[model samples]
Target: MKFDELDGKMRSFETHHDRAVMPEMYVVARIDGRGFTRLTKEKHDFEKPFDERFHDYMLTTVQHLMNCGFNIVYGYTQSDEISLLFHLNENAFSRKERKWNSILAGEASAKFSLLLGDLASFDCRLCEFPNSGLVTDYFRWRNEDAHRNALSAHCYWLLRKQGNSATEATQRINRFNTADKNELLFSNGINYNDLPAWQKRGSGIYWKDEEINGFNPVTQQTVNTIRKKLYINKNLPFSEEYSKLINNIIEISGR
Candidate 1:
């Protein structure tokens, strides 16, 4: 089939004097796992900062979200929390936020439940942010906090594993001065192995999953598999559907 036949327009670029449609302000969706901390504490030996089995479980969770169509612009694993950023193209998706977010969350939870069986648990929700400086700052703030929390947890986990009590471990970090903590966390967020055992066993952004059992690129097959579910490769891709949905919802809600 010709590209234009499927898209209903010239798929090739055409430079024109037309002013580019200003994208309806970008939407930022943040999804997090629920019950992960308790699950982590229960399943892994906290004394050991790197637990292979536990890390594999944590990464499988991340894999599910990315597959479901969300772009994980960022991630942090400290205290068993994963934070991700999804920028839905307003130009290509209408009701973009609700449709994608809902689909991603549902696909993730369902697939995760299947992948880990009973070894782990998860719940997810979307938190929208104003496309403003302050809102942008809020993401930076929370992500940074997540970074701090993760480092503290890992540092303490290591210390405790080596025989220090929880109180002593906490005090040790409070007193340990390091000039490169931020850089360390930021780097690790982009590269998973830098993280503890649970995170390392898991994959990072742009990696494919094999054991999950759902996708075949050559067959042009797709599954509701959590790992790659968010990719916007639909024949229609729901860009127009999003516009109609957003307009209708706003009209009713009067927000």
Candidate 2:
């Protein structure tokens, strides 16, 4: 076979099962740390339940993803997962699902591993939303999930600190409702409501227009200019307000 013919035949096999996201649909890529339980707890000395150092690592990874050659408008990270919201008109890689999944996973894993000084990996999957409302709801879901996970972690770690085994802590947390978990923390003198908002609501990264004053050498005057800068929000709101915040971000991105 000719060289071109042989190459064409192999390329067809590689792309035969390829999929692309539909146009006009909002794309959100969720990248989650693989085996992070053992990675965070056993292999590392990060504080139980929550740690500022670990949180900073996740935030830094998210920031890198936002700037890593994609038209991502917003990023959110909590626990060992990061969610990226792409611009509505993004057509990168011709909207290939596999391309987004593989590159995002590779980028996140590489960035995080470099930060941690260890071999860490992440897996990525994409979420498609047909409308802005659904996009808003999607973030709201993750925000609420952060709350639930935070509560559970605090309760579980409290039990462990009180001399309960891993199994005992898991069993007790499994049986407790939200109110029960809050009370458990309260009885132990740790108020769930008083915890850092970032732990309960996760952190958000988005671009905002900042006014920068630059000296115009030729004109001999300081001129104001607008620049897009990434802003990280550790203190996020909840419920309906969070939905509004998501909506506003989409609007600002020209969706």
Most accurate candidate by TM-score? 2
Against the unseen true structure, what C-alpha lDDT does each candidate score? 0.46, 0.95
lDDT of 2 by residue, 51-115 (tens): 98999999999999998889999999999999999999999999999999999999999999999
Model 2, position 45, has a per-residue lDDT of 98
Candidate 1: tens digits of C-alpha lDDT, residues 1-255: 787675655433332322322354434444556676565467534435545555445456666665555444433232344545444333333434445555656665666566556444444455554454433454445544544555565666666766989898778788765434434334445332245432322222332233355777888886655443222211111234423433332333222
- Model 2 Cα displacement at 117 (Å)? 0.5
Candidate 1 deviant stretches above 4 angstroms: 1-23, 44-47, 52-56, 69-79, 90-102, 127-147, 179-255
In candidate 2, clashing pairs total 0
TM for every model, in the order presented, reads: 0.47, 0.98
Error of 1 at 87 (Å): 4.5
